[model samples]
Target: MPSPLVVLSHLRWDFVYQRPQHVLSRLAATRPVFVVEEPVHADGSPRLEAIDAALGVTVLRPHTPVGEPGFSDAQLDVVAPLVRRWAVETEALGACDAWVYTPLATPLLDAVEPRAVVYDCMDELSAFDHAPAGLLDRERDLLGRADLVFTGGPSLYRAKKDRHSSVHCFPSSVDAAHFGQARPGAPALDEPADQRDLAHPRLGFFGVIDERLDRDVVAALAAAHPEWQVVMVGPVVKIDPAELPQAPNLHWLGGKTYDELPAYLAGWDVCLLPFARNRSTEFISPTKTLEYFAAERPVVSTPITDVADPYGDIVRLADTPAAFVGACEAALDAGDADRQRRTEAMRAVLARTSWDATAAAMGRLLDAASRAPSAHPPTPTHSSTPARATSTL
Candidate 1:
């Protein structure tokens, strides 16, 4: 039997069904998958809250007394023991593989005796707004201990390739059949309630509303065309809500579940990837870009290096607000033949990769590591998880 897979992530399982959820869920079909999320502040004694998140994946959330956020040391101090206890309780210690998403989760490496450590660097978290201190330090520590490293995009791979001997670039992949529900002739899905009443020529974006979002571009686009109803979906985090641009035609509908996204997509005329040109967005290859294509929607995006380099021609890329508005206008006014050409191009792009294939490739590497055992050795300083001292408490 395959060894159980233990995932340590900064993203919540219930938040948005993204890369980690998609890839891990597929991998879960062959073996047990346990996702350990960042600690949530709570008043009670520290405990691991286990929730079965379908696809045979169990989400383990650590509830700790520490209130500090962003995988800080204070939270780690509380999280380590809870994870150690859970690892022992589940009999996963020394018998499982550790898949890490956040660098700060490196300390918890001491909690489990992982046969192989996979660091799936999904984002450059340290470059994000309000990122916690000591993240780079943690990343350095993690790279030293990781047996294999996977990056979410080409840009990220370039950034980390020199740092690690074994680095792989597994860019985001789309679940076509699911998002295809939004296609014109596919079985009609009911329009989401909030978006149902909105007028046509709707331009929408669905993803995390954070520092990466170009609010200036969004506001300008809405202002330039009052007849166009601009819809924004997803959670607002790290930034102040009151600071968001408000206009009669602009709608910030807040976060929606993964299942609810297709319905929202079905009602949109064109999709958007309005990201700011900043360090926070330097390496982002927005997952929603392929999703929009799967839904057969025209997309307008900023010239983010990742998007511009690979998808420049397929997606309309502009930097200035005027240029962004012009691009969306072009999409909204696209003729039937143009739309057909774009859809055909999108279908071809979707054919190149998928989550299932990505997971299978990862599993192959992991299985090889399991069989070889000594292919990659851990740093001498932290070779094995330290045994807990019963009298410490």
Candidate 2:
């Protein structure tokens, strides 16, 4: 019989940004899946209704809110009880053969006594200012105990390989069929008034407007090409919109639902990812890169390692402001023949790298973990262990 799987993550189904749901939705075909998430939104009240509908997985969110920014005491208050409850619940769910913990909830792994533990390190949490102190230590403990580990990008995999015997790079992937359907005449979301009036060729980008974005590069490009309207869609995280060096040509249309993304991408002449060189941005395998290609839109991105690989053939890479502006112009000016060739190349790549494919890889890792010896090879329990830190995603 196939082993049952349980997924532990900070995010519940309703949270639109979580990538684990995408993978989980794909994995539901092979096994019974259960998700344990933050309790505050436990009654299926979170925006994950679509995900729940798609994945057919049981979700359990605790009634107590655990961690939050700027409140160490509150975080601990929530986590301690949450951990105890999780332990009790996992013990009750006797058929669970494996546990897959996303980074945020890995700390709770100590409570669950699963046959195999898999750590899905999808992002470098330590780099984010909001991440809790001693997070790195918890990650180190988790990695040390994890029977298998998976990273979200090549750079992340390289950075973590030495720490674990079994580490694999599984970058963000897309539901190609969903994105590829954004062809001409597809219905689009109600365009923001500011963006609605803007003249085409619409140069666009979608995703969080966070500290990783190179504002200088975006500003330079917007200013240099006043005729080309730049439309940025997504939530602003870790960065204030007022701090951005905005030009009249730049329009910031705040966060849209995931279902609306393809419609926006379909109308774009070129897609841009102008990220700064920072710890948070370094190992990121932006899911937008694949979505852009799936929509058949050409892409321009910063020289981030993960972004430069795989999609490099279809994307223009730029380091400096001038290079970025030049690349965008070049991408826009490329002949139909070149564009078609690049599009075909990207389609082939996307076919091989998809969320379904990624979930299969993860499934195999869990299968292996189930067969391997437990890492808990009888270490003496310490009353209090000093925090040890490690990287993630």
Query: Best candidate, lDDT-wise?
Result: 1
Once fitted onto the true fold, the runs of candidate 2 whose alpha carbons sit more than 4 angstroms away are 38-54, 65-77, 80-92, 97-104, 184-195, 371-393
Residue pairs in steric clash, candidate 1? Answer: none
Question: Which structure among the candidates has the greatest TM-score?
Answer: 1
Q: CA lDDT of each candidate?
A: 0.85, 0.70
TM-score of each: 0.93, 0.83
Residue 365 in model 2: lDDT: 64
The Cα error of candidate 2 at residue 240, in Å, is 2.1
Question: What would the per-residue lDDT of candidate 1 be over residues 300-358, giving only the tens digit for each residue?
Answer: 99999878877776789999999999999999989999888878777777776677888
Q: What's the CA error at residue 218 for candidate 1, in Å?
A: 0.4
Predict model 2's lDDT versus the native.
0.70
Q: Rate residue 152 of model 1 by lDDT.
A: 82
User: How do the residues 70-102 of candidate 2 rate in per-residue lDDT, one tens digit apiece?
Assistant: 224454355546545654655445645445444
CA shift of 187, model 1, Å: 1.8
